[model samples]
Target: MPVARVVVDVMLKPEILDPQGQAVSRALVRLGFDGISDVRQGKRFELEVEGPVDDDALGRIHKIAESFLANTVIEDFTVRVENGDAS
Candidate 1:
């Protein structure tokens, strides 16, 4: 068995306004970064799973993501399983 890495990307729904993202976009323009029309901010979560990340583990992670990690009312999330260390 080996350790596997899982990634969870959480982002606000398109319909929702992202103030932080807007601020970042404004800052970029102030810093002379032009031609970029829009920007959105998101959250990323990494989990280290021992042994193999089987279907059960993935299912549990999905539940965790929906239950604890993301606010379903205004956000969406995706789960991905990756092999070995990311770095």
Candidate 2:
């Protein structure tokens, strides 16, 4: 069986407020990172698929991300497929 890897990145909508991100930004400023402006926190999920990875598989993964990994109402997600060896 062929193996593949998928990465899902989840992020909050632009209109949503991210207190954790803001706190990180403030901490950066206090640490003398003056060039920093804003910050947004997000999540990454890496999946190792044991079988062949094709368009159909990617589509399913996208659905899974939408249904389980992220809150569609306030967050958006991106999916990336990578060759198994790259991982």
Candidate 3:
């Protein structure tokens, strides 16, 4: 079997408050960077998987995101399979 490449990006919901982001924005303003309004922090993951990748595996990955990788209550994630290989 070949390898499957996947990428996962997790981001906080737009409506949610981010204190760290706000702090960065304020610091930028103090540093004379004008018109910089907002900042948000997010996580990205690049993964390579062995064997075939089907819907079932994708579902499992989603569950992993929900259970471990992301805080589902405040964030949402998107998963992309970059390359699919079945050899």
Candidate 4:
């Protein structure tokens, strides 16, 4: 059976400071990657569904992202379905 893959990308809010990302940026510059001005670290979650994705499933996934995958106060997230993601 085919499976549906949903991706949730979570990131710190723009106003929130990202020390980890800053450190990476500095490291990249030291390693000869000078063109990069900045970097921001985030998280990704991939969820597998047994059937095709629908509006109701999307809504449920969004709720899961809001409640468990991301911090609403300091982070933001986006949910999207992978068109051809296969294991």
Please tell me which predicted candidate would have the highest TM-score against the true structure: 4
- Report the lDDT tens digits of candidate 1 across residue range 39-87: 9999999988887789999999999999999999999999998656557
Q: Rank the candidates by lDDT, best first.
A: 4, 1, 2, 3
**Candidate 2 lDDT score relative to the true structure:** 0.91
lDDT of each: 0.93, 0.91, 0.84, 0.94
Per-residue lDDT over 6-55 for candidate 4, one digit per residue giving the tens place of the 0 to 100 score: 99999999999999999999999899988899899999999997776899
Superposed by TM-score, candidate 3 places the C-alpha of residue 39 at a distance from the truth, in angstroms, of 1.3
| Pairs of colliding residues, candidate 2 | none
For model 2, what is the alpha-carbon lDDT of residue 46? 94
List the candidates' TM-scores in order.
0.92, 0.90, 0.75, 0.93
Per-residue accuracy of model 2 over 1-87 as CA lDDT, tens digit each: 766789999999999999989999999999998988999999999988778778888999999999999999999999998654743
Name the regions of candidate 4 deviating beyond 4 angstroms: 85-87
Best by lDDT: 4
- Lowest lDDT 10-mer window, candidate 2? 78-87
Question: Distance from true position, residue 2, model 1, in Å?
Answer: 1.6
- Model 2 CA deviation exceeding 4 Å by range: 83-87
